[model samples]
Target: MTLASDDKVLILFRHAKAEQVYGKADHERSLTARGRRDAMAAGAWLHEHELGPELVLCSTAVRTRQTWEAAVDGGACGETVEFDDSIYSGGAQTVLQTVREAAGEAQVVMVVGHNPTMAALASGLSEGDGSSAAHECLAAGFPTSSIAVLRYAGPWSGLDIGTAALERCHVSRG
Candidate 1:
């Protein structure tokens, strides 16, 4: 996918790791301490680079929401944050649909969700040298608080092949 800031800026994030819950529902699992740290670090990295988004579209899952909340707190994004239930266990196609739905309202939009799907979306949208690295990273399974920035050059409503280009990717491990 060829990324152009014109289409939309898709910053895909894999939610931080969750603590093992012996009795809680899967959707309600919370983040681990290490996950919190990584989320903050991820947020700081975005803040330092001024990569704040115009809006945040995150899964309703506790871990995903917590990840975004922690990361976005260190800086100012000036964007609306909404919990989309569809994103809770969403795949690449579902994510793409959500992004397309939200594209018109914001210049930059961030999605916080799970792996495998996130990784799949990144691989599908990315091209060039880092594509392989990105793929490996995703396939290896993204650690908590990892972010991938993609540039799409078209209308958010009209996303398609070669529409997004990978700009940069960061992984927080500490």
Candidate 2:
């Protein structure tokens, strides 16, 4: 289904900093104190910008879930938080597929997951319009609590590399 101009915002979020501990699976990692702060800051920015998400799709990983909880924290947003197991350790292409699958249900959808994938997905969908900061962040692997908004002009099923344009990119670290 082709997305309406008003129904085209796809916000990609990278999970916040994870507590350092060896031997534990990556999926079990939890956010650190600073990570919590950064997530909240990003959340504040989202709330301030009036970017209320209509749907939130997050990875089932511990860190991602924590980040979403702290960041959103009942802030200005619509209902529903769907946990997708595929995003736990998904790649850029997988992330894009996940977003495409849910394109028709909401005007704005937020996907909270891991880095490299999140960053790569942003870069892939972006038609080179991502800001220098965005490029830098994606190049460096999105840090804790980063958000990238991509505006797609076509149907989600047709979404491919460089099909969308990065409209906004923000990292709480800075």
**Compared with the true structure, what per-residue lDDT tens digits does model 1 show for residues 1-174?**
322456567888888879897899989999998888888888888887777787888899999988888786655263788889888867888988988887575778888898777777877776443455655655566666788887776678876545677767789754
- Candidate 2 regions exceeding 4 Å error are 1-7, 74-78, 130-133
| lDDT computed for candidate 1 | 0.77
Q: Estimate, for each residue in 109-170, the C-alpha lDDT of model 2 and write its tens digit.
A: 88889877888788878857757766665666567788887777656677789877787788
Give the TM-score comparing model 2 with the true structure, all chains together. Answer: 0.88
For residue 37, what is the lDDT in candidate 2?
81
TM-score of predicted model 1? 0.87
Candidate 2, residue 83: Cα displacement in angstroms equals: 0.4
TM per candidate = 0.87, 0.88
